[model samples]
Target chain A: MKAIVVERGENTPSLIETPVPEPADGEALVRTLRVGIDGTDFEVLNGNHGGFPAGDDHQIIGHEAVGVVEDPNGTGLENGQLVVPTVRRPPEGSNEYFERGEPDMAPPGTYLERGIDGAHGFMSEYFTSPEEYLVTIPDEFAETGILVEPMSNTVKALEHAFASRSMFDWSPETALVLGNGPLGLLTLAMLDQTVERSYCLGRRDRPDPTIDIIDELGATYVDSRETPVSEIADVHEPVDFVYEATGYAKHAFETVEALAPNGVGVLLGIPEDWTFDIDGGRLHREIVLENKVILGSVNSHLRHFESAKESLARVPDWFTDDIITDVFSPINAEQALSSGNNRIKTVIEFDTR
Target chain B: MKAIVVERGENTPSLIETPVPEPADGEALVRTLRVGIDGTDFEVLNGNHGGFPAGDDHQIIGHEAVGVVEDPNGTGLENGQLVVPTVRRPPEGSNEYFERGEPDMAPPGTYLERGIDGAHGFMSEYFTSPEEYLVTIPDEFAETGILVEPMSNTVKALEHAFASRSMFDWSPETALVLGNGPLGLLTLAMLDQTVERSYCLGRRDRPDPTIDIIDELGATYVDSRETPVSEIADVHEPVDFVYEATGYAKHAFETVEALAPNGVGVLLGIPEDWTFDIDGGRLHREIVLENKVILGSVNSHLRHFESAKESLARVPDWFTDDIITDVFSPINAEQALSSGNNRIKTVIEFDTR
Candidate 1:
């Protein structure tokens, strides 16, 4: 079997040959169909974000993945069944989070991501996973199942943002998406279902595909160079909900001033260490006096994956076509890993069948 | 009738002669019994927080008040009934907050606070309020009814805090109260009923009466000067719920590190402008990875006042006696306002019955 791996002290992916893994009890053998490459992959490649597999110099790195079962190995999974694997396997110990089937709520240093942390990823020809970690999807998702993992995170973030306002009559009329990245576009598409008005803020110039998609969805796109998040209320109306996908740190505070009364902001970005001065009192007052809430969400639970399946089914086919701009074969995986920000979404194809 | 008023450019409260108000068709004339003095009153006197009434050079300064109805004016309220008036009144013209009975959630400029902003407060010997603004209380609350106004705010804060976590099975075991002033003490007293183990953080040293009362309640007293909030998890177990009552801006950011996984912090303090540098990335990462929530809560609605009446009834007599350390007559109201931090709670009595 062939796999793409990032060795210690090396910040680039390389082709490596390894033997195919045999599925043990309660495990199923899967042949990768497609694997998504994201910003986390860049972080892992640069050795800046996640950890390497224990006792191994390299880790196979791809979390947003789709595969077809090759061997059931006595599990309930069927051979050739289409499946998507969820991220965040429990660490080697007694973890109440995985015990309760909620690894999404687990604290950091307690759980490991399949591709980004202690476990080897599915950016290979073959992989083995516990049957419980795989979610069976319909045949229609075979081409787009690689998107399920990222969409699931947005599902959980929006669910919690609404849940935080469940105690009041919070009918949000307008929403703002702080980043025009892949995650922000998906969040904007989801909010379009409920929010009457929506806007997406990005630093991109015109003629960008993401901006075109924002316009196609009937959402206003404000170039962040012309209008920052703090001045959003002055340039446009204050939003009732803010979806922050840019891990810039300052947006977390700026979201407070940009929200209308009784609004909520859902934060999904995680940034590196940076120090900055902020008007802490104004941010505190807006939240306290206006009855606002800021919720921090990361990863996704199994239920969110199920909801994401329905949410993805609702997205028009043109969006999927417009968002995924690059698809690379395993032989050219390095090109997919080093793609610039202009690329909307990148994927590595292991097998078509 | 005599009233305490704050004149323009003078931060001191002075006695003034005024006519007893006449109850209109929808209004009820109330004779003030006792008015509680809090930090908000001081802010109004300093002219740094709230605004003076429109077209007036002076503002009456008391909001935490309990009184007896002298005239019902054909309203549902009964004459001689014990009543507590809510602080916020809808601004002139149509307002949605007052219409929905949720003035607490109103935006900052949409409403006015009696005594603190744009309206004459209950500090006068006689005051008029629309019948809908008064909450009827039991006879037992006559002595302690003044506490209802401040306690109502905590009720609203805790209610929203728990509501934010309702989607999960959140059973908070340990809690932290960030201040030992009147609001923090009341919050700790309320939390003592449900939280198993609790701690109160204050700068007070030994032999302080607030510390003694904290001991009486069986909660650990932490000297914040020695143990900062950032080191709470190392010094004591990380808390599941944090009640912030200190208006110091830094405590808001420090709360992110003090919370346990999936925990929440409810901020009730309102601070002034202060610029400070913080490691924003660490704060953002902790919230996202741990599923932590920060809720900002301010004034209370009418329902909170009703719940507060019940919460007040639950307090033992010794607590009520020990907490209210100072009681002053109107002629000595100046002394009441300038009392030192050693005083646990202060009140100015206008009438005993």
Candidate 2:
């Protein structure tokens, strides 16, 4: 099996021949179809993110993947079906969270996230996944099934954000998403169901195709470099929900300021340690006086994956088309792995035959 | 009418004779019985909390009071009925939040807070309030009804903390209350109903009455000055919910690290502007990876006040008795308002005549 692998602390991942995996009982042998590359994969290659398997000298670098079960191995999983495996698995002697189907909220250092952390990834021609970890997608979404991984995160974030406001009769009319990447755009797409007005913020100075996609989704795109998020509220109204995926530490603080009264900020960014000055006292008072909620959510559960599958199944064709800006063949796998900013999403293709 | 009035930018409050208030149409004349003095009142006197009312040189120094209706003025409130008037009222030409019965979540600078920010307070022998602003309490809690104001804030915080965790079956077993002040103690009293192993952290060194109350309620009291909260988890298990009432900004930051997976830190503290060095990057990662929630809750709504009245109704007599340490007449109002660190809660009393 040809796999894109990166040695520990290596910046570049190279194609290598690894032994093909076998399906054990209750596991399925899945042939990789497509793998999406995002900022997290880049972090793992650069030794920036946590959860590198302790004993493995090389880490397979991809978490958002789509594939087909070649062999069910008595798991009841059907062959010729597209599936996206969940990233995080329960830790040693699984705690109450995982026992209850909530590995997404498992205690830190307890779960092993495939590709980005402790487990081997699905960025190979063949990988085996437990029957419970794989969620099937409809045949209609085969081309875009890889998106289910990232989309599920947005699904879980929205679930918790709405849950935070359940104390009162909260109906948010507006939302702000702080980033124009694949995850941010997906968040904007999900917010359409909950809010009337949604704004997407990015660092670009001019019009981009991603901006057009944002507009096509009935959301306004504001260039953070020219028009700050604070000014966006001035031009419009204070955002009731802010989905932050910028991976910049400062935007987390700025998201706090961007919230309306009783607003919720769902943070999904993982940034480098950078000290920024903030008026701790005023922030405290604002949180207390305004009843603000900031939730830090990572990973997703099986339910979220199922929700993401439904979202993709019913989504407008244009959204799925515009999101995956570039796709590369196995020969051009390196290009897909090292995607530039010009692309909204870059995926590497694999052949089943 | 004799009132405790603190002139703007002054620390000393004087007992001054002011004109007794009269009930206007759709209003009720309430005969003030007793007003509880918390740290917020002291902040008002020291010019560190909020401002004096417009067109007035002084701010009345109380928001937590238990009183009786003298005249309903055709508003349907029965005379001699025990009541606690809310401190915050909606702004002129009320907004959506106020109209929806959530004035507590009103945007900053939009609502006027009685005693604390804009409107006059309840620290007078006679006061007038809108009929809708008053919540009735049963006769059994008359002596402890003054605790309702602070308890309402905790009620709202708990409501939100649970709301944030509503996405899954997250029933917390352990809790941590970061302060032994009146507000922190009240939070412990509330957490008693939800969790099993509740812990209270305070700066006190030796055996105190508050600790005794915490023990009596089946909660552990940690002397923060001796054993830091970070170590509390090391000695025991990591906490699931932390109610922060310590007016120190650093505790809010530390609270994030002390939480378990899906843990929520409900911040009720209003600290001064002191910038502390924190690893923002690491903190962001902790939030994302652990699925932690931090909610900044300030005020409460009528529902919360009613819920607080219910909590107080079912509370043990010893818990209520030990909380209110001292009660003073109008002549000793200064002593009541200027309670030292040793006291839990102090109140200034007034006669209905």
Candidate 3:
């Protein structure tokens, strides 16, 4: 099978022939259909993430993918069914993976190119994963099933936002999302049901159509270049909920400042450094005086993925194929990564036929 | 009337004779009883607080205080009534102290000594304030009314905690208090009704009776000097609610790190510097995986002060007068500030009679 392999760290991925995986017990062999490219994929290719090793070695590159089952190993998964697989495969029986005595591991070497010893990815003709990691896609999601992974992440963040208030009786009336990237835009979409007023903050000329989707979703847009966030917050009557997705430390501080007295700030972005300087005094004052909340969110859970799959079934109507500026065959993976167009999302289409 | 006055910036406060203030309409002349020393007072004394003008001399020390009304100008304030006044006193309909429409800005001039243009403070024989600021004490509370101010602050912190979750149905099963100061200890006492299990983190051998009271209140003590916080958290199963009252940034970060997934970390302590470092990745991961909340709190509302008065009415039974380590006449204000004993709370007992 032809696959995009990262031969060395900080090097462009190359097209190479690799052995196609077979279905093991409780696993399904999936023929690749569409694989999405994300920032994490770029990082993995550069050997910059904790999940991957420091030096670049041969690794397949893709986690956000959708494929049709070619063969099933008695896992009740039907052949020809489309599915999305889990990204992280923790060691089995470890307390870190499962809390309720469930098989929650993503299956060994299943994260496509990004796990312990990069496994062959769906950015090729075929890949195999455990039944537990695969969520069947609805027939209506055929056009946009590849977005399940990223959409599931947005779902995870929203779930965190909702869960933080699980013991409380209220929902956020207004939410401010501090970025207009793909994830941030998807966050805007996910929050449409929960937040009455949503604000998306971004640069002035980023041509990602998510901005249009944000406006279509009825969220206000704040161009960070033209207007200060403080002034925007003033007009918005102070945000009750803020989603920090800019991945910038300064935006994290500003999100806290932009919150209402008892507001909740959800930190979703991963800043480069472990250390971040925030206004501790102001945050302390807010906590004591107004009861403000600052929270953080990371990856998606299985439940989030399930809900995201259900949510993604409706994405084609909200966002069409036009949003995907370009699609490269697995052979042209380097070109897909190098093309710096203002595309909302890029996907690699494998010629399984 | 004898009072300690700051004549100019960076000048030591000197005892001097000043004319007794007469009660104007809607005002009360309170014969000073006791003043509690705090870091804020220390900042004010050193001319470091931005709230006061540095060059403008003739300022008075003390904000946390209790006294007896010698004269009442209407407003139904009774003479000889023991009371604690709210520190902020802004004129109605004035934006000088508060923003015109914002409730948070409605009250201004939190500095009792610096509020009315170098006004004399309750750290004197006599002090005058508006009747609206005075909170009446029960007849049984005269001897220990001095604690009403600090206790009220605890009430505010608790109120902020409760109000921040008012939108949600959250009732914390476990709570952690990250300080052993008077306010931190008082917060532990106040949390008795809300939290099931409480933990207080502080230094070992810090002789404050609040330790005993905290134990009495059913809270476990974790000596930061002896036990690493992570080990403590491993034993305690992660805190559901964390109150950071240590006024240390590092403590705040550690407290947040020790919180359970989906737990609330409330910032109540204000460090001197506004800057603090936080682990953004950990925070983001916690928020995403567990849906945790980080909250901030500050001074209380009028309702919180009223609750403090009610709580103080019962303090004699729970907290002994021994918490008041030393009592000084207004003339010895400098001596009270210099004493480095584990003074839980020091009160300046004015020779009001």
For each candidate, report its DockQ versus the true two-chain complex. 0.75, 0.68, 0.25
DockQ (C-alpha) of model 1? Answer: 0.75
Better of 1 and 3 by DockQ: 1
Per the 3 Å backbone cut-off, how many clashing residue pairs does candidate 1 have? 0
- Model 1 chain A, poorest ten-residue lDDT window? A48-57
Rate residue A199 of model 3 by lDDT: 92
User: Just chain B of model 2: what TM-score?
Assistant: 0.96
Model 2 misplaced regions, further than 4 Å:
A7-11, A18-20, A47-59, A91-93, A205-207, A215-218, A227-237, B7-11, B17-20, B47-59, B215-218, B227-237
Predicted model with the maximum TM-score: 1
Better of 1 and 2 by TM-score: 1
| DockQ top scorer | 1
- Global lDDT scores for all candidate models: 0.89, 0.85, 0.67
Classify candidate 1 by CAPRI docking class.
medium
- What is residue A329's positional error in candidate 1, in angstroms? 1.5
Task: Give a tens-digit lDDT track for model 1, residues A1-353.
Answer: 99999988899999899899899899999999999888888888998646888888899989999999999999999999999999889899849889888888888889989989888999999999999889889988887899899999999988888888876678999999999988898888888888899999999888888999999999999888999999999999999999989998888888988899889998888887888999888788778878889889989889999999999898999988888888999999888899676688898998685
Worst 10 residues of 2 chain A by lDDT: A47-56
Candidate 3 residue lDDT tens string, B246-286:
77766665765687654667776666557766765555554
Residue B152 displacement (Å), model 1: 1.2
lDDT of 2 at B19: 92
Q: A246, model 1: CA deviation in Å?
A: 1.6
TM-score of 1: 0.96
